[model samples]
Target: MTSPSQEEDDVEEWRVLYQETFGYRRPLFHPEHAVFQFQPDPKFPGHQRNNNRERREENDVDEEEDVEEWNPWKESYEQLSRGVHVMNSFEQFVGAADIQCFDHIDEALKFLDENPEGHHEKLIFLHEGTHNVNHTIRIASDVQIIGASSSEDIAASVILTGRHATILEIQEGARSPYLGWITVKYEVDTEHEAEMALIMEVDAPPPPEPNSSGAVADNDDDDDLEKVNEIESDQTTNCAMVVTGRGVEPIIESCHFQSGNADHHTVVVKDHAAPKIKNSKFIGGSGGGIIITHQAAGYYDTCEFAQNLRSGIRVQFQANPYFYKCAVHHQGEVGVFILDDGLGHFQNCDIFSNAKFGVELTSPNANPTITECEIHHGELGGICVHEEATGQFLKNRVHNNAFLAVWICGGANPILRQNEIFDGKHGGILVHRYGKGLIEDNEIYGNVLAGIFVETGAQPWIRNNHIHSGKQAGVYFYDNGSGILEGNEINGNTLTGVQIRTGANPRILKNRIWNNDNGVLIHEGGQGCLEENTVFDNTTTNVFIQTEATPTVRKNKIFGSRETGILITDGGKGTIEDNEIFDNGQAGVMILSEATPIIQLNRVHGNRSAGIEVSSKGECVVRENRVFRNRFGGIMIASGSNVADSSLNQVYDNLDRVSKAIDRGHCLFSVSGKEFYPMHNFYRCITCNSSDRNGICQSCIKVCHKGHTVMFLRCDRFYCDCGADHLERSCCLRQS
Candidate 1:
């Protein structure tokens, strides 16, 4: 009845004494060499015993306590024993053959060559710690290769160190080959760069044939010849990942791929191969992380691509890749580059910190849908849809990029909605080179330039966005760019809130434009419709129209401006109608520099200067405006060739009804005794007492009518006698 520790010490002393007497040490038993045996526990007869004997001693000491206590090590051991027994039963059920174990690449290849077709549906284990498989290893159909846990357990997994080559390839007709827990590393020379570390080549489907002609050939063999040609064309062709006549999809899971060569790709799936990769990591590749091209498709889940020299994932030539919960970051180029008619759908992905654009969709007809993604902090831009590429960017946080957050160019149309694009070096969104799309409900602000810039004939519908706090205009449309800007809050910009210049004609409607240099500036011949926009509290004019730009300004609440509410200058002409232009520092509507704007039906009041001012060389049609309550004249018509067709306007309640400044002897009208009279005579008395009165001189008012009640009169022509309205009786002479 010895204690376990005391017995262990006695046995160790005896073993050392025996070893010293024999002049040798006992051989150590390795875990791999020792057979795993299971024995039933006494306390729980059905359950297997744990390898640790002290647990059995403890159970014997307190049986009741042991029955209730939970031992994690015992539980794990029992579970592993049951798993091994179940596996043995399953082996019997499937008539499992012996699993082939290889210590070297040549041994594995030799075994595969010996049992080429016979080893179908069998399992192979690689035991090599690390094998530099310089040549490509083609996996057969229904064969699965499982690597050891670590490089020490099996020599390390396959490493493709060859130049201009791939390590492992599933050739044509190799259906459903499973590759698990494999590591592929590349160290190719730069002179002979490799294409891909691992490539899966499959046969592409044949193209659809055209319809046959109705005309029957004289030879009956013509039909047979055509059938033969069709069969020949339908035959499988050789390409990368050639999966010809295969039913099961090739899968590579739990694998790590790395490369350093400039032209090497971590993995390439081409020629219609559809591979599913899960829980894979691609790191430090000089080429790209993964490339699916030539109509090849892939489904990647829970994958990470980091620090690649090229794009993290590149799909081209009609290749379609769907990624879920993937992180593609710190790449040299774009995180995801879809081009050449390639289509990709990425969901719940993080694509950021790339050298170029985070996600770039280029080439004609290439469309990618990126939803619920955070694309930010790239060197160039966030997302680029160019060269006729069309895509949908929904609920993406694209910000803090070098240039534009979302750049659409070269006739591309991308729908950007619910994206927060801000804190960038340049604009938030740039649509140029005929790019057109719907930019709706996005927070585009905090950029160096405009929040949304449309140039070079690009026409994008920008609506319901908060485009504010920008260095330049909130929405700038130049170089013939035009779009529908509706329901946007464009404010707090350093320059104009919405600037349409250089012949751009953007329809601006219902936008809150405030706290900018100019609320809406239409200059350089830009033409558009500014309607129902609340443009106020601007540092300069609320709505500035200059340089021959003509925009129809209607129904806009333009007030609280530092300058004129609506300044039309420099030959600008448009219909200014029904706008509440008031509370400005200068004239509410200033028409200057030969500008002829049709100002009609506007409530121009509460201004510091004239309600509507027409300066020298300015000729405008000002009519039907309620111009009142201004600090200066209601309507100021300057001298020196300024002409304003001011009519039917309620120009009253101002400092002056009309302030007409006259210089020199070019008399416009004669004002005398609180009335404006037309001057048609210089020397004759236009106002006389009798009808047959002689031509009284200008001195008659002072000499003849001395101490008499003399009334002032407005005469139409220079006549000798005055009318009865001005005189007490009719004149003696008949005045014509």
Candidate 2:
């Protein structure tokens, strides 16, 4: 038995011997573990090494302790078992189609123009493997340049980092001052070659020396300003005029773009050109990451933009970029920035920790559709829909933002609906003055401030939402916004569940507001309608009319509140009627200020406080009610509220008019009352009555405190079965 390493050495010798029989250009030549493509050898004398025919019954002998390492008997068995196929390196790899490699970037760019391989099918690689770019390369129509990977597996082997622009902005300017002062030619005249003269008359111009002021004195101050204005002509312009302009379409995909690491941009398209990009990752340099100008619709999808000094993607001069499914993070200043009426539609992108907003579509008509994206844990809001820009946001989950979920200052109509927003310090949606927008059906919960914050003068129609568990009310209407608030279930919030303040006459109707501190609180001169709502079980008052707002509170089931059911504090008034207010801990109605209320026809009962309590000195009428069975008096007129000899207020308690016996236990009752509205006045009859506990038929007299009584046929008190009673005429009763 020989060693395994020695056995491998024998195999390499046999492979080298067989490769000399065939002629082939080699690839990855190593003696021991060489590719069989280069070393196509099979015929060897050591291939016929026969196996050992020793005695069976475990006849094995090895004096060496490391038997696994010293034995080489099984080595040749593997080579004989699995035959190897020699790969032809020429046929294995084609001559690298779709890539025009050049020794220099200039040569590669020369090929980009003369080269016919554009968007149809072609890719370029700047394979100079050096960090030098004295001449820039302008990307022509529909051409892509991708860098080469070092290894086949692409682990880590690109040592050469060429500092060059993957796509450079070909700047073109006016030839002379006459072109700037043109009164006739409006559009860029690219056809007629105007022989425009050079304005600069520089003869043997000196090299522009830096660190010694700019072509003049060091702060000549007023003189420098005059000199700057003198050279402000087209002579100092650095632009090549478009001799024959072409509508450019190019995509700089999967290339390492470097620009001196200064505050410069990577891909600069200053002209009116739109580039479509996909599946590209960019490691940016000092310049702006991507700059679009004029009317360029730069469409980018599934791109990763990271580690840039300036904005991730910037658009200016009415040029915007449409982005979809792009990851933009770890940028220097702002991410996905658009200024000066530039617009873009951003969809399904992860934008977090950006210094500014995720996507900024500023100015007017710069609207965008931002939908179906999870924008969470961002430094600012998930999206800032402001600056006269409108947006349509749907099905987005914006959570854990430092600011509001969405900041909307839309000057026009913006629609933001069906978004679940939470975990922010501010409101979920903030609408400011020039903001006209529709907020509907957004699950805004567990935030610090109001859910939908609309300021004064914003009449946005808010409808159909589930807002719960916010720090303030669900929808805070302020700043004179008279929107319609309907069909919203606002529950379990801390403050007024839905506050319509700031003189906003919001139609607060058909909203199920419950379990908050106060169900619906209105203040500061908003005269609106609050009708057809089941406002119930709030901790504080159901509806608080504060600060001169007189909302019409009618046909609302205001019940089970801890404080007054309808607390009309301050100076607010409404016609209160037909509300089934029952079983609350406080009064069914509380009227404060100088509020003269037409209180009529409300079923106010079983409240601990008075049914209709007045707290102000005013002329009011409380008329016509079966208001009874309250813990305190039915109607309490407080100290400062009762007018001078109030005659219009009617109160009723235990009225008898030939009525039948009361259902509970009243002993004596008249049965011949035809026109009766529950004409029986019922009581327990404790002193002269007796009946079974939990029995359906209540006694017609007052029951005793611990014992009942018996009223006989002649008004005598017999000892009833349940208690002890007195004797008036002739009947007997027992105490039981």
Candidate 3:
């Protein structure tokens, strides 16, 4: 049994022996490999390369472990196994079907130009060495130019260095010509005569043949010539490769492209040309790595771009390209930039470590879709869609960014859905500067700032997202930000679940907000509609409204608070109506500090303290509410505070009926405050009341039952029936 390292040494020795015999480095192979066209040399006689070697059992080792080490010429081995004849050198070659060999590339091209009738598919192999040309080589037929490199580095071994305006041009009418395993480098100063290293354009076709009348017919050939001249004489420079001409499609694989100067891009595809580029690398370019514009499109797979001066890839001018599994990193600017009506789709790509945003889209006409990509470690944000751009970002994992993971600003209206955005230094998503977005179904957490932040007059519709475990608020609206927040689950934040301040007015509806310091905090003149929400189990209060905040809290279920269900303080004023407030550690509704709210139609019960407590100069209109089943007294009003018009309130079934005892057996409207105490008279309408708890105060008697039959009562059990359904007419006191 041979050691693995010894076997590798033996293979290398055999390769060297074959190289000496064939005048070219040969690939060592096992019997199971592809068939190779190995020509016999007179000096080798009857000795066969494979037959002379000791064979090994296939089951002795795993195929992957026994595989050869990766080398630049490995692809050539596969090609050879496919029955491609390997030439010893460019000058000495045997022929195969549609396969041609030439000592110089120019000669081979000249032959194709001379005899262009028969061969639609041709394979031309270039020897592994530098091929210098003064003029551009144009291909107008379906041909494949493959490099036969035997060196450790394919690109370095099969180099194409040129100082011409263009190195290789695939003209119009060419059908998917392939260029593989080669390096194309521009050598001239970019500021000079060189316009591009490679250009594909439509050239003038052969003039129409003479007809029977012995005259050439007029056609669009002249127009074609003019277009060609325009492209050749264009003043714009510094693009290493250009793919132009409508409907032109080419294949470029396993190639390395380098620019001439700091202002040269590696490739530019425009004018609707579509190319298929695979397993290539664009590195250290002064300009962008690739530019797709002018309605051009391309499919790039398993490519790499790094250290570019501009964006790794830029798409504009209605171009729509697809990038699959590409690695774009270490860029001087954004990893990918789409603007100027650009549209692209990126999937399964790793974009990170860029100087700016990993992916950026701008302009009103820019719309792209990015999916299933891992975008991280950006110097700035992971993705930015601004300047009125629109895009769809779905199912991406964007994390560890220096700023917000995704920023939608400047009137942009992108859709961000089903993405996992977390662990950023800033917020997960930001909509600012009048931006608008539809952000939904995303899992955003572990950010230093808010999970989703809308500020500076931006309005974004946020829904159905799981935002939790953040250092700051789950959702923040500031500086006049306004939007609709619905169907989101926000919890476990270090700060408030929803923080609305600084004049922000957001409609929060149908959301479950819990397990935060404060479930909802509306302060600093903030105002909005908080409706149809479930706010519970907060560390502090379920809802805190303070500092002149005036929000409409309606149709919500607020319960299970660590403290009060709803805390209104510091001049807070709002309409808290139609809510189910219960099971709080403290008062169901606590009001203080001159805060005035309209507390109406709420079912306040099951609290450790009073169902509704107003103190410290607080004033409110407590009307048409059912206050019951509380541990403390119902509707407790302190000395300096008052319920301005306590009408139609059924305050009953409390552990302590102290508020009813303090009412002095008078109607709630009359005993709620000092101002209303003068009207202490109580009455009962025989037609409306069937029990001692059904009665009316003097204010309600004079205003609500003006024409109904009534009877005087001592108010032994004081309650109001004016707002209930027992009356023939609506109560005037309750209406007011």
10 residues in a row with least lDDT, candidate 2? 176-185
Return the TM-score for each candidate structure: 0.68, 0.61, 0.74
Q: State the local distance difference test value for candidate 1.
A: 0.67
Candidates in order have lDDT scores of 0.67, 0.54, 0.77
State the displacement of the C-alpha of residue 673, model 3, in Å, after optimal TM-score superposition.
29
Q: lDDT per residue, candidate 2, 149-193, as tens digits?
A: 223321112112322222233323211100000000011122221
Between the candidate structures 1 and 2, which one is better when assessed by lDDT? Answer: 1
Q: What CA root-mean-square deviation does each model show from the true structure?
A: 14.5, 16.6, 14.2
lDDT of 3 by residue, 553-581 (tens): 99999999878899999999999999999
Expressed as tens digits, the lDDT of each residue in 592-647 for candidate 1 is 78888899999988987678777647777888899989865687665543455576
Global fold similarity of model 1 (TM-score): 0.68
- Flag regions of model 3 displaced more than 4 Å: 1-104, 117-121, 188-237, 657-736
The collision pairs in model 3 are: 167-197
Considering TM-score, which of the candidate structures 1 and 3 is the better prediction for this target?
A: 3
Model 3 poorest 10 in a row by lDDT:
671-680
